[model samples]
Target: MELRVGTLNLASGRDGGGRSVDAAGLRAALADVDADVLAVQEVDVGQPRSHGVDQPAEVAAALGASDWRFAAAVTGTPDPFRSWTPVDPPVLRASWETLTGPHYGIALVSRLPVRRWSVLPLGAGRAKLPLQAPDPRTGETRWWWFPDEPRLAIAAELEHATVVSTHLSFAPHTALRQLTRLRRWCARLPGPVVLAGDLNLVGPVPARVFGAPRLVSEPSYPAPGPRVQFDHLLGRVAASRPEVRRLTIGDHRLVTVSVHPG
Candidate 1:
């Protein structure tokens, strides 16, 4: 059987143009992906800024995916130097206590049946760097001091394989640590496993660190004109070349790969 999977960074519920994410656009974008499983990053859950909408749930619903999990990295609006508390397990797959407060993190949604679910916390790093992004004053690209946030990875054990997704720290040194830790976790899973997301490590570095072949090698950030392969899908499985898609809503372009199971 062939399984299609993709990674999408919601960019915190908005487009590169800063418009709030909506179901219609989500549906259209997901239609293009037609993925059976999608790993989402920068998701907002029950947040006032996003009108309290459950972003991961909304995306899942849009894709008609019945299986989904959102691992909260922090509660309330995110701050540079640690201003939010981390929620524990049972806090997700998210709907349980989402109404209790707001949350920001990553998610995994699957149209396929999921036999198990898991989460991992990659502690926040103490490095801040100026990264390339749109300049608020000029509406052009410029390097701005970006702060790293607490990162989280979510995984789903489907009948055939286990897949993981996460958004790593922008700080290179810290990202390396998280990747190493995640690799150890993957080693214990089933025969074949795949990992996907905005790893923050560019090019062959992620594949090298992950000890897996990268399925996609397209630049996915700065959606306007991508120039780096920050988004990726890497693993030891048969997969078609990844398709980098431009979604109507999101700062990062969606990257999809078709997996052919043996």
Candidate 2:
């Protein structure tokens, strides 16, 4: 059976303006594509900035997925320096307590029944990245030093394939290191594997590092007029090369891929 997979950076479910996340609009947009497995980044859980929305749950419900998992990369607000608290889970578990503040992370939602799941921590003892922050006085974005936030790869074993979802660091070196570790880890898993996420790198960087062919190529950032193809889907499964399409859902463009297993 052909499986439809997708990946998107939700930007905390906010539109381009970062004003608010319209759950209805998101649901409607997702319902239009109806992918079997969806991987999303920048999802929020009980976050004030996004109005304490359980973004994964909302999206899963919207898509009518049977199973969904969220691995928290940061435990507090979005600001990495001010209030962000990194969470390091020993194992990938489904349950998460309602945190006092906001929780930011990646999520995977699957319509296919999940056989098992695992979470790999890739943010240990890494140096912080300089983020562009808005200047309070001039309303301009400036580079500011912030702690290297935690990153995780959530692997879900479905009936036919093992799908891994991850969001890597913006820093090139850190992302490359994490990609290496991820390749090593996925090697131990059984069956064919499909790796999907926002790698934060351009061109064939991930394909070369992971030794997997990119299933599709499409620009998925800065929704209005995307110029970079940051989001990707790469895998070892023998299938037709997927064609990625962009769906405008609020502020960000949701990228979807369709794979037909041979």
Candidate 3:
């Protein structure tokens, strides 16, 4: 069986003018990918930034998926302007109180059949870190220090194999530890799993750090002129080369791969 999986970081659906693009624009951008399973990071839910669009729901609609989950990592926004609180006992959509602020985290959507779902929590990095962002006025890259929020990976049991989506910490050592933990977690799950996400690890470091084959290799960051590949799709299963494509919504490109399992 073959499964098409995609991973992308949604920058709150910003357009060329650095303005919000509603659900229609988001659907339009996803028209070509046609992934059976898609994992997205840096996602916003009930947030003013993306016009309060439930991004995961819209993305699931675009993919014609019936199973989807937005793994909420924080209760508030993580930008320099606002403070965020870690989500305790992270599972939601089961039974939980209304989130205090706009939620930001990673998500997973699947057009394929699902048996069960699971979430693995990776604690937040110890300190704030400088992240590069493009200046709104000049379009020049600028460094801004922002607090690190808690991280987690959402895994789904698909028909053919288990699938996982995650976003690791920007802190190098922390990310490395998370990767190791993630690898071990996947090892215990059902056989022939596909792990997809923005690992924040460069080049072959992620593969070497663990021992999974990275399905995609080309640089996917800074979409226009790529330099380093911070995005990855790793598994021991056979897979075709991914189509690393760019969207107007995010700084990083999306990677979609086709996995084959016997």
Candidate 4:
């Protein structure tokens, strides 16, 4: 069997202006790539910044995918500055009517049907990191300690293999711990497995921790001028050795890996 897997961070389905995505443009970009499965991170759901759009559904619809699943890392109303600075309004608090609907997280979309799915939440604990934020009294970008948010890994079981998608912590030590936990989790799944996502760690760190081989080694961050390879595709099955290529998709570099199984 042959499978093409792709991974990218959607950055909340926008081109960085908090403006709603151009559906036509997204559809065109996805159509240009040939992938059986796609793993996405930083997807938004019913959030006001994204114009209350369901990004996973939109991307799946754009690609004409048969199955897709979204796992929310943060379910409450988003604290805009707590995570990162937003392009538009910095805050959209959970109010009387909209308290429980808005969310942000990751997703997996597949052309092939999914037999089963699972989610694994990973993080050491909430910590804080210095992020540039607008001052409450005066609108000035100042370094503020933002809480390091927890993350989740979503997996889908297809006819041929299992695909796991995750976004790890930006902190190196924290990310290493999450990667270790992910490896242990993947060990129990059946058949060939491919782990794909933006790990936030560079070089051979992921391969070393996951005990898997990387499919490609191409820079895939800060799209305009990629300096590091954060997005990756790693395989655990001995029978599968995939070939990967990078594609420029909007603000992100989409990684596509072609797997030929024995």
Candidate 5:
């Protein structure tokens, strides 16, 4: 079977005007990727900012996936950083309030059954450098935003393979440490692995440090006319080569890939 994987920005819930994310536009964008499993970035679980839409669940329902899981990079309330927290998961008839209830950071959506799951934390502290993009005030170069904690890596074990997704820090040094943590995690897995998300590497750091291939040749941030490649899909393919794509719809782009089993 041809397994499709997708990584989308989801605009972190709105456009420049701070409007709600377009549900129809989001559904259309998801349909365009049509991946078997999807890795989403900037998803708003229970924020009023997103108009009470549990982004991952809504998208999964729209796509009719048999299974889905979310790992929140940030939560709606204060920060303590626990191993796991309980919240009402999203469902078909789940209300906007229910749908938009508190959510885990990052997430994994799949058509196949997920046998197991775990969340890995990458420690903080590293240099963040802003990129030069087309913006009015800054006119180009902007400072990179570093989260309180390093980026997260969420993994799931399935009947056939293991897949992971995370948003890497924009800081080069921080990103390198994050990738190193990811490598250590990958070393302990017992099956084929596919890692995807916003890599934030514009240069050769990905190849040099991660030992994974860049699925596409384009930038994922700055929406319209992206000049830097921040998102990525990578991993070991066993006896097969990974198939990755950089999909652009309107002002957003998604990076998706598939790893064939040996």
Candidate 6:
């Protein structure tokens, strides 16, 4: 069976007119790539940033997927910003307690038949160390250190193989820790496996550091600019070189991997 995967960073709901408004470019981008299984990051379920649109569901529907699942990395409290960023229309906005604040999360949608689904939420926080590396060619400091919640990976038992998707932490150290943890998780799974998401390592690390064979990495972030591949897709099954494509939808660019198992 062929497995097609995609990853996108849906800008926060704060920018979307507080409702489900078709993001002009985004809608077209999705139509262009037409992935069978999509893993999206920075999707908001209930926030004005995305105009309170259920981004995951909307995208799934747009892509003609029959099933979809979402896992929140950060579940906003009902009044998280009440004491912090209070609004001017306090009394009016207070009437609807549930309609306040944006809830950020990640999601996986698929057209392939799924037998089971599971999620692992990587803790949210900053890296403990400062990673400072200078570009060899430009002699410029590439600040690779930044704190972000631990990545959340999704696992699914597909009809022919197991599929996994995750967004890695920004900090190199955090990503290292996450990679080690991912290896452990992969060891326990049975049968051929397909792993995809923002692995955060752009260049030669996929085969060197991770030690996985038959892997493909593609640039999927900061669309239409200097390409720095932050997204990736890997598989355990031996096969031909997987095809990689970049999809820029809305304001985010997604990477899609098409893999063939041996």
Best by TM-score: 3
Better of 1 and 6 by lDDT: 1
Per-residue lDDT for 162-226 in model 3, tens only? 98999999898999999999989989888788888999999999988768888888899978888
Candidate 4 deviation (Cα RMSD): 6.3
Pairs clashing within candidate 6: 13-48, 13-49, 13-50, 14-49, 18-51, 19-51, 26-249, 26-250, 123-150, 124-149
Model 5 collision count: 10
The most accurate candidate by lDDT is 3
lDDT of each: 0.78, 0.75, 0.80, 0.71, 0.60, 0.57
Q: In candidate 2, where is summed lDDT lowest over 10 consecutive residues?
A: 133-142
lDDT of 2 by residue, 5-46 (tens): 888887766554444456676676566666799888878787
Q: Looking at candidate 4, what is the lDDT of residue 20?
A: 41
A best-first ranking of the candidates according to their TM-score comes to 3, 1, 2, 4, 5, 6
Cα RMSD, each candidate: 3.5, 3.5, 3.2, 6.3, 6.5, 9.4
Q: For candidate 1, lDDT tens digit of each residue in 1-262?
A: 7889899888765665675546565555566468899999988777654556778878888888977888888776543313556665435654333455777789999999989888877787888777654432223455666567778888888988888989999888999999999998888887488898989999999899989999888899867788888898998889985699888778888899998767
User: Cα miss at 26, model 6 (Å)?
Assistant: 4.9
State candidate 2's TM-score. 0.86
Score residue 180 of candidate 5 by CA lDDT: 83
lDDT of 5 by residue, 1-262 (tens): 4466667666544444435455665565566556777776656576544555677777787676777766655544322222223332322221222433455356667777778777777755534334322221112323333334335777767777787877777677788778888978977876677777776677456756877665554666656666776777666663233333433332346665555655
Question: What is residue 155's positional error in candidate 1, in angstroms?
Answer: 1.2
Q: Indicate the residue-level lDDT of 215 in model 3.
A: 87
lDDT of residue 41 for candidate 5: 64
TM of each candidate vs. truth? 0.88, 0.86, 0.90, 0.81, 0.74, 0.73
Which lDDT value does model 4 have at 238? 41
